[model samples]
Target chain A: MTSARSNNTRLLTVFTILSVLFMIGWWQETDVSIVRADESDIGFRVNPVIPTNQEEKNASWFRLNLKSGDTQPLQMNVTNTLKKDITMKCVPTVAVTNPIGQVLYNQMTPKRDDTLQMDFTKIGPRPFTFKIPAGKTMVVTQVIKVPKTNFNGAVFGGFVFYSNDVNAAHQQSASSSKRGVSMFNQYQIVVATVLNINKAAEVTPDLRIDRVTPMAYRGNPAVTAQFHNTKPAVIEGQQMSFNARVYYRGGKKVLFRNVTNQMNFAPNSTIDYVISWGNTRMQPGNYTLRTKVTTGGAGPSWNLVKNFTITGNQADKLNKGTKRADYSWLIIFLIIAGLMLVAILIAWVYRAGKRSSVKNAGH
Target chain B: MKKSWSTALSVAALALVAAPVFGNVASVQAAGPKSGDAALSGVGYANTNGASGWPAAGVEPQTASGTSVAGIGFVAGDLTLNQVPVFDFGVHNIGSSETFSMQPVDSAFRPQKLSGNPITADTKANAGVRALVVTDSRAQMTQTAGYQVILQFSPLQSAKVNDSGQFLDAKGSATTDPTKFTYNTGTDNKPVTMSGASLQFSSASVNPSTDWNAFIGDSLDFGDKAAIYPAIYTNSGKSGPVPAGSMYTTQTRLAAKDAPAAVGTSIDEGKAQVIYRANMKTGFGTWAYDFTAPSSVTMKIPSANQQTGTWVSQLTWVLVDDPTQDHANPIISQLEQ
Candidate 1:
């Protein structure tokens, strides 16, 4: 009984001590991906979210189609596979480069934690140099500023991953010699920006005239033409000077009559161009005014014309064509007496045409 | 055995009188109701259903048979066993626009929890994130665009206990608004104007990205690598010398020969000027944290020797011969020691 009791006490004591030690070790460790003195998680956490694009290989960098107008700070996961206590900085950068080390855009990037700004350049293996702690993982992230160009395709940049897994790094590192650290083993994240983008060429603009009705007022004629620019972009995007000329049918060839006017076409705009056969530009006569507008480089020429006849002698414009007398009285007197004669003539014509065909058949 | 017997007897009596406490209470709950009848078979029979309930918070039971599957949440072994501490964060394309929002995986950093922490939402906190910039390539026109986001985080910095005896520097509460999000419209709002950020919400205007997901970052110091900086789309109908409004609007790099001069300096090469202010009262030197994992408390190794030299974002290392030997060279010291 004594022996059994002592054995029980010793077993319980050893077990209790072991339990306490386990608890202490658990409580004291700071495994960055797995845990810490207070936190047990410290090493790599390959987030359960599956890789979306085919370019997303094992331990490769990727481009998130994350576009935001807001400039707020953001945090992302540096998802890993290892479950060791580790702490790493998650940093973000917009590549001014491609995977093959071609410098696409070179800008000075600012450091996330410090006041330092990183100027991008070609290093040995990685695209950019970043710091990762021993036994800790680093998360690369940044608050994507809303870019001016909202792109439709994927961005081609290099996501250079670096680790202190090299022998030199391990030998030089002073932090946590006991925590078996995997000297920095790194590979560049050849992030193939897979994007589903849609784009369309802008619509071609053409001028359509609503109406070119020619009208006469006080023995003077004028032609009005409506013009419009139906495009999304501003038509007057470039500074353009303009001029136009008017022409008329002078017997055979068309004649030019300059319209003293200058105007602009706003992008997708509609405006009216009016040309008059008034005394200043033309005399009171039967004439056609053809208007021609010239715009700056590469623009199609505009040619439009309308004809109007002046009537009555109101002196504003002389009716150059033969003027008609007041013939309403003569026409009215004749129509009063012609109803019977018209009926007899119609009967005769019908009989005569039938007789001619019959005579030809008999012959 | 006597002590355990007395404790079990005491627990048995307490079961009749009061609540359970101390020494594997979960096990006691798992042991099931007493196998005897109370009140001489007149009182209530054994309450076998008690074992079917959920374990109390922070309690651990060895077996799962007694508890219902629905009642038991998966328990994790502590972090000491290389189970949960290693953390890695990155910007991954979770398919497309269908996914992307602020979500922190750790229990401590969930968006809702960060929103409630006592924080100093200052320029330093803002430094952790960068604005998106124009990423359109050279073409007659940059149509159909997309942006590249770079995430950064440096090692943590230890804040000294302040005058009030509180280890306070900057703490903050974070809230996210996924709306007010847009891409390159080629108008007043430009993506190129918003890349490589170092400051977070020191301003009331800064908001999270539209297609943002949860990322890990420091609550106090913005790592030279920690900020969540967004960038311009590939090509969305706008290019030809990144619009003057881009964040890298003015990007001029020092030549290879001139790079050494920029080793310890923070210079501005872009028009979006960012200023960094020191919090020290008296004269102070510029300071950066040593990114490293701490050792166990054996008390045998010297603390000065426990530093991991600084590397540029897990890439290049600018290390000393020995972290423990700050100024002393071991080669030279062998002659003197």
Candidate 2:
């Protein structure tokens, strides 16, 4: 009976040990799985993120018919919205596409956003795509510039944003006042106007010198001249530069005591300005004036030059001749008498030379 | 009989000494599992290159693939302050004690660290651990997902009146104001809203009796909730005066060039204490803070237009996130008194 009791006790102990081992193993496996499951959750998820798009603002594009080599610029705006545990980055790029889906201009690096001077003659109409990630939005655009020389094939280019870890994955967090789930998947484009210059400066607008008058002054004199911009279009913000050279008989600039302001003029605009030798006595003699005006934005497309002269008034002779020259009948009679005297001198000189030649022939 | 008892006792002692030898004596084993974890400093340092101080100029958000875009709220209207606050935060697996460490990531920025590593208590997941984050602006108690975050206030280096006005020790005492600092955090992982936010100084070197120039550094944890929407962090409840503490009474930094009759209520009132950057003069030690809002959210104060005054404002700051790190949460900076 004792041996049987001992056997029963050993059997019970063995069963208890097995049961405990099984439970422990089961618990460990369960724990491992739960822990691992949480880790797996950290992996990637296609959480519906916001999208980045093109910026749309009314930008005026200048349309000019020309060969090619012209390009213009447009800008887009970008914004970002994301919460904690997520960082966002952005890389902006720009590409111009034709109606047939061909890229004209491709730029990805951050560019200076100062207005892009565009030349539409070279570049043609093209669409742009801006692709960016979660953290930020961008304003990407293109500028059209008319190259000095024209090209055969039309090229269009715009700016866009690409993606990168810097602007996305480790997105900088937003402040509470501005915080929110940052708008994700950003993309946008801004459309702007393009200006085109198709013609040369000379034929486009020429400044014709009507007259240069040296007015009598108490001391100094004034040079009055006019300019005109004949082209149908109004030149915006055009600056004209000119050099004035005055001379007496010889080609020399007058030593004017004072000059006011740089020669300023507008396209198709005319004005009268002065060049005075302030309060100083003037040197009386035949004087000539030379003036030149530079074309503005349409550089070289509007270079202008004009030269003319004004006879100097004689000092004492001016007073003696003034009365007679001023008297209506005296002025007319002097003009007629001078012509008659010239005619009589020609007749007498012709007869006298003829008689001398006749006497030589007789001898 | 007593002698026999003594002999038995001697025999018993010998048996006790040799008991281990007779038993299936084996080599000593580890008390617990073989955990291969590194110890974590209550504070850790990280290199903050492109991620610290100010956002890179024209830095838009980007994606992991370096292809997509992410968004950040507008802080400095034109330029983003890509200032990444470096933090020593990671699991100390082996000696995985919950601890806090506050040392300067950059000495010129601030000086101090909290206890870190060797956790005060081990919590499997949602258990709470208290953490203090010292920034330039206000001090805050945060109830994070599994821990509590307390931001320590650093003295600002820019101020017209009291360049050292914001200088307080780790305990948050001041020379001009008697401070009373309180916490609105749950003992555990519950949201401690503003209502429970109270502050007072244990002691002050300032004259609190005659002049009431008390100042409190308050912070708001725009944690999971209110992460996106605009909310007001104030001194009093939602509508009370900005609880300027004694600073309001002392009114050291005049609200206006000329004093306002009602203090912050007149034409020169700041609505809330603030300093615009364009208005900042270099070398002026001002109040600074790091007002961290998760997921790149925006923060604003009440009054007319209260912003979560950040580093740029010289009021608050933020630490940048580096996804390459363990938890990637940067320690933000703000004021320097």
What are the lDDT scores of the predictions, listed in order? 0.26, 0.26
Give the per-residue lDDT of model 1 (tens digit) for B1-337: 9999999999989776434333333333223221111111010111111212223443323232232334312221110111101122222332222111221334332221113233222101111111111111211111111111122222122222223322222232121111111212235543222111111212111113322112222322222222222111111111233222221110111111111000111111111111111111200111111111111000111121222221111211211010011111101100000
Q: Specify the CAPRI tier of model 1.
A: incorrect
Model 2 segments beyond 4 Å from truth? A1-203, A214-220, A231-240, A251-253, A257-265, A282-285, A292-363, B1-337
Candidate 2 lDDT over residue span A1-363, tens digit each: 999999999998998998899899765433221100011111111111111221211111112344345343332233332322223222222222111111112223334222123322224333333333332232222334455563222212222222223233322331111211111111111121212245422223335555555542212234544434333222222133444555565655455422221122222323343354333344456665555455445554433334544444534322331212335578799999999999999999999999999999999
Q: TM-score of each candidate?
A: 0.18, 0.19
Off by over 4 Å in 1: A1-84, A96-154, A158-363, B1-337
* TM-score, cand. 1 vs. native: 0.18
Scored against the true structure, residue B197 in model 2 reaches a CA lDDT of 11
Question: How big is the positional error of residue B17 in model 1, measured in Å on the Cα after superposition?
Answer: 31
CAPRI band for model 2: incorrect
